[model samples]
Target: MKIGIISDSHDNIDAIAKAVEILNNSNVDLTIHLGDIVSPFCFDWFKKLRSDFLGVFGNNDGEVLFLDKKSEGVLHKPPFEVEIDRKEFILMHEPFGIEKLKTQYDYVLYGHLHKVDIRKTDRGCIINPGELCGCLTKKRTMVILNTTDNQTQLITV
Candidate 1:
């Protein structure tokens, strides 16, 4: 199955809207977010549209419960795991957590730095979707992963 990944949105509604448009065009089975959705509006936008999403909390995610209140997606605090299409996927908001969780899942996804990159370790793949808000890095990005075959792709917005 095709899965879409996004993170560090930092509440840029326009950017998230663009990313959501891109994701919707990709024919993904679902979308998973790494965190920093930014504001209540951003969270509400996704909740009102899509029914499939998973997320985690980042250091800058102020008022966590507020975002969760409108989330149709899954949110993780630190280390969280889910099996999609029979493959185990782990998610976190920080890179350090990815390093620590390397050996525990088939894939480890994180976001903190507003830069998009992917690395393959002995245990699994670590990916950062970057900041879709395009604030710090002046670039927006997202990721797509194929749960069945371990294929990954990074998309810049």
Candidate 2:
């Protein structure tokens, strides 16, 4: 299974649209948003995704109730744990205590710093797909992870 990961969209509709297109074209089995989505209106772009998506609230995500409604209850508070493809995964908006969580999950995915970080540890992998809005690093990025092999491709959209 291939999972698409995106984060820190910050309400850039254009970037979000592009990312959705890329993920759809890539035929990802699932899409994960690492938050900083900013506003509920952003879901207008996100709704185009072909695959189901899950998300965690970032510090900038203020309209929690509406976001949850917009996401149809797929959005949750940070540090959410999920099992996908028979692998344990933890999703969070902030990279807090990631090192400690690494031992517990097959994948530790988080976003907040608006930078791309991907590394394989002895236990699993740590991934941050960067900022989809390109507000900080001036580069829009996302990730596609193959669960079968645990390999990831960093995509700049």
User: Largest lDDT belongs to which candidate?
Assistant: 2
- The residue-level lDDT of candidate 1 at 109 comes to 85
RMSD of each: 1.9, 0.7
Candidate 2 structure quality by residue, lDDT tens digits, 11-128: 9999999999999999998999999999999998888899999989999999999999999999989899999999999999989898889888999999999999999977669999
Q: Which tens-of-lDDT digit does each residue in 1-157 have in candidate 1?
A: 8888888888888888888788878888788888888676686567533437878888888878877776733677876778877767888887775666777777888888888878877755778878888899888888888766667888886
Candidate 2 global lDDT: 0.93
